[model samples]
Target: MHYESPVREPLVIGDKTYHDITRDVARPIETTAPKMWWIAFSIAMAMFLWGVGGILWTIANGIGSWGLNKTVGWAWDITNFVWWVGIGHAGTLISAVLLLFRQKWRMSINRSAEAMTIFSVIQAALFPVIHMGRVWLAYFVLPIPNQFGSLWVNFNSPLLWDVFALSTYLSVSTVFWYVGLIPDFAMIRDRAVNPIQKHIYKILSFGWGGKVKHWQRFEEVSLVLAGLATPLVLSVHTIVSMDFATSVIPGWHTTIFPPYFVAGAIFSGFAMVQTLLIITRKLFNLEDYITIQHIEMMNIIIMLTGSIVGVAYITELFIAWYSGVEYEQYAFLNRATGPYWWAYWSMMTCNVFSPQFMWSKKLRTNLIFTFIISIVVNIGMWFERFVIIVTSLHRDYLPSSWSMFSPTAVDIAFFLGSIGFFFVLFLLYARTFPVIAQAELKTILKSSGEKHKKHHSDDNHGHH
Candidate 1:
């Protein structure tokens, strides 16, 4: 007599097998491009071109081409810079922090999340260079010794720390992303029928072969990198927050900034992940692999981080009022009722109020509502940065210097263009690579599918 294995809920549905995982994940890469892919790619390219035009015009005419003025020198450019950087944080959290915690569900999404991290950081890095006005001499921020007086970067300055932090984050993320792709690249190399495709994948795979030793080394290396990246996921944003916190500006100076910024980063980053994955799962017919369960789990994270961000908002208000510092008090009061009141309220509504919907299971699980709220969360996060930067800078202690900032056509173009750039990279990645981790998914097959359990039972009975 044979005993049955206990039934479990499937993470990868549609009764998928290990072979099915490989075929489904690799199909997008090996097959011809779909019409929708081309249409999307075309739109992204157009936006990228517009961004290029904006950058070139700025370089030619100087920073004056932007809406920046004396009262608000750091306007749209820095706001966009911080927004992109924050958006990258969710990828690191999903990949590194989740991995450390032994979360198996992350295997399906970590590949694309890491890719998003690298691309978003690239977009974030652009703003600082272009904002320099004299783009060629931007390297002056580095600590390299120079002929003129052996000038060195300021160690105590947060701005200098940003240069180092960003560079380090980009380098580590790129290496981590590429290392994870090697196994999948080898799988693709084995599957390729065309000589050119086979050769390309061979180089990309770095001669990876599925030996026991190779698998052992892969696991060890992944664990080590994940450990390293976990701290960075926290530190990078903390340093970014320091850019504001260290400043004497009333609205910007606060003790709650480090944790607050980190929470907001994860909030925005998860929203972006949802926005991309919802479209991807639909377009690629990957409903079985990237299931509703995955979507719901991500929404839960967004809700958690969104709540933390909301608390940070209220804390800032309370701290300002409690301190009785007139400057700090006015900063909070002005944020809610000043000329930029609309932006502030928009941030409050989207970040604080919208996420409250997730308390209902029905709303969290509903795809359309989740998608819409995810977008709203990102918009709110962006406005949160804008409000922090602009409102803090626009008004001075000497009321005579108080002024408002309005974005120019170039500023608008660059911001919209950056969105296009991000999407363009993502679309290309979806078509050219395994968006899901096929090998990792195979490892969990026995635990996730009825077919795997039945197969295991048959093998056990035969041995008996």
Candidate 2:
């Protein structure tokens, strides 16, 4: 029943077999850590420790440790939150949305993308919690009963909706991720020579024996979850957009925010995925499994989303000018020409202009160019959030309140620390977990694997 068009390139290159797939995937976990892994881990660990120090400093010193001023109340914290959250969007899109569409290419990269989603969402969640200053009072954001005179969370607040949206997204994504891991865990369990390893994977695998019923249920649950998660990929970021759109602030208030934010999220999320997958393929020597076809496929998505983001940018400017509201127009103008103009232009160059290069088939398919563009797109995304959040708030209605914002060392540390922490989690996951879904990849081996394609071609040549 498995069929792939002959014109389509093979997904799994280099004549890989099922056994080879399992061995290559399990190698990192079974073998001793390579020196490069150790070196990378040490660097990431150092960065994470430095970030931890910054978090501790903030906790000890309060919000005063940041560079937030009266005019710019929300700065790096919100920017980073949105950026991380945006990055988190790609995982579910890759896993859930693509699954619903029955895209087989997802099988290779979906595992790591899901991990990235969970880890990045964790990083995004940290900012709002830390921004609370009184971290103990963070529980108040939740609706649980407290001793504070029966006070409840405000239902109207978009922030509360974020709590619901982000938590739901995380829960579903985690379940979806773990469910996919079960069969792979069982693979490792069966392969384990060490009793302790076997015992651990046994529990992790949940007694999966590759029964027909097991697969049937797995497919059912995955379809159900994908259906559930598909809406989330859109809803979560839409609610996030409401955080800005609901506000009455000039640049902040707009109907375009929801779609704009969602597109930007996908744009940046794919870029991060590209960054992670490229590095992963290099480090793990998974070039055959994670092929150029996969890279080109991802690049196509990046290009599409990046174009959508660019259009959103222009739409925002048009709306600002067309709205006839002086403040709104001024906000957009200031973004490009004000003190923060550099950030705005950086966003433009990175986000708006860079992805245009993907139009070239040669460039999008080229590994090195793709990697560079991926980093560029992420940088642009960060700047985009900064421009949107800061530029809007820095200038108020009254001239007296207008002031520029700057980040203190603590602010920089927290941002760098989050990056460190993200990589720390990803590195550990890459080493321990099956970074690629071997079970799923096996299903498509006959249809899209290189060996099968070679055979098909040879048969056609013989008939000719």
Candidate 3:
């Protein structure tokens, strides 16, 4: 029953045994820090500290330190917020949705993808909190008792919905990720040589006994969580799109936003996964586990989502023109031809045209080409958010209310600092956690492993 087609490339190459997997995954954690890890860690730490300094500067100086005028109030912070949230979408999709559909390919990459989701969502959560001029008053966004004077939260607002949606997402994703890590934690617990290490992992593993009933319950719980999480994969991004779709802004007011945002989120999310996994496999020497097949599978997703995003872009333009609404048409036109036209074209070229390169089988499988394209796609996705937020607001119906927007040094700092912060978390996770879900990977070895497949073929030949 466990037979993979001959045409299907092996998921795990190098004829790896189960022991080899445990050894490879544990090596980075058990061994002393490698030179490259230190180099990468030092650079990431510097970036994180710089960003922390920027965050402190903003807190001290107030929102005035940021580049916000009356007309273009929501700029870089909101843009980055949406961008980070979009990046988190791929993790849930890979873990929850793929799990529901019974995709075995997810086994190798889900751990890192889920970690990326949790970290990126952390970054996303920070923006809205900081965007509030008084971070102390952030509790006002939540619905609390009337004892606190009259700071009632508006139930109708998408902003309020964002608070609810994002929190739920972060909570569910964290739980899902941790639940899946239990068995892996137990594996490390058993392997730990040091008493302290053993005690730490033993507690983390929750005294998992690997009993028949324990595994039975584990499988049921994973399925239940996956089922619960599957809808969130769609709902989270749909709600995120509502932040714009529910708006009256010309470019922002569109029915297509929910699906459009969802697709764009997956598009950018997959690209980020590619970016991280490429570096991870190389750094950890996990080529046998995270293979070209994995890379190609991810690329194929990036292409599909990228193409959907391209169509959405075209649909937006056509809708703007066809709606006979001058304001809508002007919004799209200004994006392509106004002061921030560079941003618009960058989005187009990077999000739309760059992914088209993946149409070639040779290119999608090419690691260097995939890495470069991955970066390009993320850059394009960032520009896409910028153009949408900045362009739509810069020129409104009333000429007197119209004004341009630019970022202060603080704006740049917060953005770059977030990147550093994200990597700092991921690098730590890479070192400490099993980057690949080794337990789940073992399930696929008999069917999709190169050596196992050859053995099965020989047995068939002998029988015949």
For each candidate, the alpha-carbon lDDT, in order, equals 0.90, 0.93, 0.92
Top lDDT hit: 2
- TM-score of every prediction relative to native: 0.96, 0.98, 0.98
lDDT of 3: 0.92
User: In model 3, what is the error at residue 433, expressed in angstroms?
Assistant: 0.6
lDDT of 2 by residue, 1-464 (tens): 67777788898988688999999999888988778888988888888888898899999999999999999999999999999999999999999999999999999999999999999999999999999999988888899898988899998999999999999988889999999999999999999999999999999999999999989999999999999999998999999999999999999999988999999999999999999999999988889888898899889899899899899999989999999999999999999999999999999999989999989999999999999999999999999999999999999999899999999999998999999999999999998898999999899999899899888877878998
Q: How close to the true structure is residue 352 of candidate 1, measured as C-alpha lDDT?
A: 89
Residue pairs in collision within model 3 = none
Over 4 Å off, model 3:
149-151
Q: Report the C-alpha lDDT of model 1 over 1-464, residue by residue, as the tens digit.
A: 22334353457777786778889999999888888889999999999889989999999998999998889989899999999999999888988899999887788888888888989999999998999999999889989888789678899999999998899999998888888899999999999999999999999999999899999999899899999999988889999999999999999999899999999999999999998899899888888888888888999999899999999999999999999999999999999999999999999999989998998899988999999999999999999999999999899888899999999999988998898899899999999888998887788777765576666667878998
